[model samples]
Target: MASGTSQAPEDGGVMPSRAPELLSGNPDVTPDAIRATEKKKVEAPYGQWKSDITKEALFRGSRKLLSPRVCSRTGRTFFTEARPDGIYHLVEASQSGATYSCHTVLPEGYSARSRVYEYGGGADDGKGDDGDAGPRVIFCNFSDCTVQILDVDTEKVTCLLAESDTLRYADFAAPPRPGSPWVLAVQEDHASAVPDQVRNYVVVIHTATGEVRRAVEGADFYMYPSFSADGGKIAWVQWDFPDMPWSGVKLYWADWNDEDGAVSNVEWVAGEDGMTVTEPRWGADGFLYFCYEKTNYRQFYRRRPGGDMALLDLKRYEEAEFGSASMFIGSHTYAILSKECIVAVATENGSDKVIAFNPETLQSQDLSLPLSEITYDGLYRLSDTSFIVIGGGDTTPQAFYLVDITDNDDGARDNRKLTNIRWSIDEVLNPEIFSTPQHIHFSAKSGPKREIHGFYWPPHNLEYKGPEGTKPPLIVQSHGGPTGHTGPGLALSMQYWNARGYATFAINYSGSDGHGKTYRELLNGRWGAIDVNDIAESVRHLSSSTSTPPLIDGRRVGIRGGSAGGYSVLQALCQHPALFAGGACYYGISDVKLLLQETHKMESHYVDFLLFTPGMTDADKEQVMRDRSPVHHAGNITAPLLICHGEDDKVVPISQAYTMYDDIRARGGEVKLVKFPGEGHGFRKGGELAQGA
Candidate 1:
């Protein structure tokens, strides 16, 4: 490999000397030149050849597995799995002889999905078997957004409520009492002239009578309607406009009437003011346990009947997040085991672990599971010392595991054992081709030397190696949610790049979750600047020859992301054009001001926190928004770019991509735009995903 010289063009732009040579074609073609060209095309670079990890495999191989629930009476674990046919099936798994028998509980053509708030949650929940009613599962039908019940014995599916296009339901819970036919769920009604006028609240559905009645109303959003063990009390969480659940929420509880099926004496329990609360669960001891953020970190608190709330202190682990931001309903962070113990998942430094805390003693016992990270709301305690969780490591995909803590006679650190209940996908791809991520921390660009974190995955392939003395290209990935964290899981999409001779870096830039509140607020009023700088610095850090040999080729660095991450990619390229060779933006936001006006109601006020400053005039705020928008600076992005968007995306519409493509093309820059029909904010169909990959 030869080093290329950087030169300043007469147009006041920096240009590489090797750029012209790579783009120019020789006018005089000789027989030797033609032969050389043929040889170069036929022989591919090491690790760059097509392998078994094709685009189809990348999309179809990994199964969508989430929301694990255990039936206490039958000890059967059930979960939702998205099959290759685009239908989400409810699967039930029973353990036997070093393996598990898994069967689909839902009939053909039935999908357990919810579209409430666009990103649905609490799609399915099961009721334990009673002598009279037998076993049943309640779920939100994706086809009509109506609540449906499935009989475990008869396998008969029946709608609990009449199907209506204006009504959607999620986050369901059935009373623990046997022979109980009433189900509690959050309902969203869209029968209004104005979309923003739609009503959201909690409702009770009588399975036997097929009657749906409002249980709680007057709140903009409601979730997690839980019933106590005795069925005498109920609890839930609610939030209003201009404030997402992550920003603030209110927890409420009231007495339940089994005969009348109504709630009374409703009172605010916790999460008043601007505190964020989530996942309210009733313990066996008749105490209400929920997660709330009073300090900088989210932690668990318990409230006894007629008593004030008390913190469940895990003394050694005081700085971790006990609950995650409520992006969707059914975000379970903790579960009750017995009257004295609680099993919870806590996150620190962008990783998650399962811990058992005794509320009586206020001490935590570390359940040393084999996996490094656990999925959010994956913990379900079946017995006093036994539980099930979905988790994975750097090279492992998310899978279900049965964990037993009853044999913890040795101690807290090394007592528990885990049995793999099921894998998200069969291990068909070669493990040798998978690359493990190294957690890298580098200094922020303009902050007070604060550290920015990212996962760096180097190219790995057993069959091929890069050309001698040459570094592989790098792809910088920005995760969505701007508030969401990218965990160290073996994602097939990231591995696809690694297997194809590319180094990948996933940045958890400022404003990302898992970090403390102070670090998460680093992007407040500086969304584009802070995130873009962090991404650019990450690329520079990997490209510099700090090690014996650089891990990435600086001249071939590119950026890519979806949603908020896509916004970061576009801004990074426009702000630092010379640093990135090219970029790929999927449903990215190019104009902040436009997004603020057109985004969904759930995130309508989100831009106020990311872009607005206090006491700024309307004109001043508009200038700031335009100044940070990538569309306004498209001329600055000289590198080649690829933009993709779903035609039905409501969050960041396709017009954003079209405007960006047109702007870059008008400036004489290379650009391409691809739009998918019938797709929304995220691609779901296998064909669309394969093409995007």
Candidate 2:
């Protein structure tokens, strides 16, 4: 990797000073009044915020925060940390059972390839510094895989799969494929594959020969490949264009043709089966276990060849959403971490039970960590026993952890941190006054089993406790993805707001992940309904109880969100105009009908899944689209709203914001429109949009 010290001055741009500070509460809203209202909101059956604050507190604690340049895996003793120096360093400790070492591998002339995407490699150890033994990596540069590999000895580029779009490390093809080691790479080409040729082929590369072999091709798109135990085959999931990977996809497999030195006999494994198979893996015995969503809930399942897919262990709860956790990568099974017998990350029934199952014994265990809330990403296994986990929940930033399975039998254990991820954010956060979040859940309606989950942070002061006991105002936040879940990860944003004296409520609405497929699908065909209720329930929770965070003047509540969250914000304003006093939306979907027509090729048909319509006809599409569109109902939105968009946005066109602004203004609604040229669905050109948005 080229030295990044020279480039740090340019890439490490200084933070801006004019950032908008978070408001603690309404200026006129007294602390005493807030305390009184809290009790009322809690006593009122409709108020859910009080319980939310209490629950938020349940999931709070210190978390690891690291730089964005690196990624970590579970089960690995050490984690990979990408430095501003343009190098990825492998750090491990013996207590975790993985050795630590740094390798400098970069291709020549790369002159500092952007560290946009880099993932760490687990120890294969004997391979040597030059891609022989040490750590391996799988990363992607927006242009290609060039940013992923660098020569440890020379810090020079060693392996660059320029032809491949992205690369990710999977459990070594079990038993190790002979001749050359194999890793999966998702590649795209305009030609070659048939049926549908949008993204082309899935390539399996031979590390020794630099030979790239096509495994499977011809689909709208595919990602997340896993190797079957025998090393003779591969299993992966595929979904077509316009459909988000989570909505629905098909699982597939292919046999290796040793003589041909490539993949042959490609076919979908139970292709038409009505199941959403995610995180597929093959156990040592060759049984395929994967998480599947059916009947509105996501559950893990195992399948033996020629046998039916059977559910392993699962939780069916209408009150508590399950399957909200996302598995960035998967292995055959998770190693036990704490003596508590929890799965560490994948818990069953909220208990930390050691799940040793029959070939069909599906057991679940919950591993409660020090933090009350958490959001984890990538998983890695080290020496096939220990585990390393990445990504932290709300209070924690992306940190790497080392868990020794051997210690699980004893109740006394402390998972060691290989690096201090918190160091990165400590300078920015005021530790003394940081407020912890409380977790809470509430029923969506009068008697439905469905519920919403969220964490609420109450206002705090450095010196003054309160003026004879006062409560703080609150900001209800609806998370992005409309499909994504709200994990217990700490955010500078949340702390910044809390320090300023405002309480913030961030909720995982009905369709959010963690609660399984059924809850995940609640938003489907009912996007406007469930999402709206989830937010309202949060407000009710806050306004009614002293046990919860204090509420500001009911007339002064405000809301802000981006993308799907932005859509929710717009929806809230239209459906409950008096609920939020002000709203800010960033790249939110403004028009359901327009989004269906103008979305990127990768997600062109996604609206069909959410809106519950084929979207095949103009009239049918228009009706459903109009029903959910906030823009269509803008005339009724009385709250003042700030709209921000990227000029080049394709996910949700910039025009969506413009059209809404024009219409709202035409109808005498307060609105602000901000536009950035040469931008896309997301902001990339620094804080320009952040400043305006």
Candidate 3:
């Protein structure tokens, strides 16, 4: 990593004397009611404007609605909802006459969450009709970290797999046979001889006997244990250490023996070292469907039972990705609708949209969706033509919708006929005060000289405006995952700050998804340096030279982010202290070495590919890591810093925060550290979020 500081001038109490440039994500749609000068408005300085949005309102509306699981037999869709009160509920949504309703179906204190890879996903699966027993969902109980089954209708809890201190299971797959006793899942054995050497394999769980038996074993990691329609064969994906799921994986199919639980004759179907294989799904027609990248995009592909794997049709839009860089198990980018058709989440240019494909003919088209602009959390195949998906757009908050394409013609692709039911829209959002984010692309100042992607939200509130000729204070956010993307979605946090007359720019940086694989691979072996330089460039690009009138006050600019993003916040403050006035880091990495030891099993080796260059010796890597570690340079960061960490976080341990705080405070630097108890890598409770905000 280079020790060079930014050449951009420092923020020496110099206020930018021009109005911030307002860029709209939607320029042609509606008249600007937020900036209507004719309306009487409260005049105030930037970053201090007052509006209806408050911390209480911002967090009260925040709910984690994800992991949508649908039961075809019961016509009910299940979703995991994490509320501010700290109870994680398995919410069931079913359609009534003209509307739909969602309510919790899980027992009290029973949360439908997974802890497999430490950053758990793939914790629950719903299918099978158990006669008078009704629909049931099998999930990993977060309380004891065990696998359990819950009867959806009766709300009865049954133990399928016993609790284990060393074993964790996720990405469950149940046989298609009604009332089948067998289901498959990816099981992780954490009781390895070497603590960090967590072993991963597949197992078959006997629902009737409450017994878990090994089915398949070999890979360093396993995911999506999908069974064939007839339950004779199974298909799954596997990857090894040093390669993230998005980097490389292999798909395999095998024979399943009913007499004794075992998977045999496993054969590699697809995937290679450079390619990424997503959730392997078995269509009703017995074809295995998945997404992988051979070129620059993760295109769709499917394999027939005894035929070679072939690419599915993208309908001439092959440049877009049919799948995403899925980080967790049970992540669905596409679902097998039928042998003829499949509905998938296609990401293009940093936006998510649903694209329906004719797999046999290799043709696809954009679905006529009401929330057509942005879709996330993947698609669930409920029936042959109807699938439940979570989608939203620039003006739309993320909501649940049951898309029924059975009645629509191929040409119209209409969305009005689609069933959009009840959502987590408890808060009434006034569109007049919401500041829309406009997509902005700028060049990096150093290292590679490529385009960087981000969104700019100009401060907007119908009731307030900044006085005179001063621009707004900018919050340049570095999103988590570092592999994550920031788009123009309706975010209450962004709006709350905007209502307070604070301009914000969220940069996708170099390694963000939705872009091609080439762009995503840019962070390979140069995580902190590349991402930090991009952050500095984001402030420099928007603060002065690029925008005509300059969209922000360079002197009052700050940075905030969490997880990997928090790491960037620290690096941004340390590497380019002059560019940022302050920084807020939440559960961020302080020392690269600490991260190597403290992070979870799934992301343990991720640092190797992200920051360690190929062929670098262990000693060489350590030297490089120490150079980039924020803990080593805390004494040099003069900017006021706020560090927040969940005490229960297993990913980036709380020790990282405490260590950083002590080092910085020992050097007489301005710093504050706050801990949220009973929280994990990310804050879930409303009060915790509000306090952190």
User: lDDT of all the models against the reference?
Assistant: 0.77, 0.52, 0.76
| Poorly placed runs, candidate 3 (over 4 Å) | 1-39, 193-195, 368-376, 406-410, 691-693
TM-score of each: 0.89, 0.72, 0.92
lDDT (tens digit, per residue) of candidate 1 on 623-651? 99999999999999988899989998977
lDDT of 3 by residue, 1-693 (tens): 111112211111111111111112335445464335535777788877777767866565456667788776766778877677666778777656755656678878688778888777877887465766678888899878778889877889888777888888888887877767888888889887353588988888888887788777767888888888888899888888878888788889999876666788988899999788887778777778788888898887778878988876566668787665566777776777776667887777676677776766666677745453343454788877778787665655666667777535653335423555434434545454678778888777676968888888999876677887888999988889878787677777777788788899888888888888989889888898888888887787788857878989889898999999999999988888888889999899999898888777788888887888879998999898999899998877989999999999988999999999999999999999999989898887886677666
Instruction: Please tell me which model should have the higher lDDT, number 1 or number 3.
Output: 1
Tell me the lDDT of model 3 at 301: 78
Model 2, residue 434: distance off in Å is 2.5
Error of 3 at 598 (Å): 2.2
The clash count for each model shown is 0, 95, 1
Weakest 10 consecutive residues of candidate 2 by summed lDDT: 1-10
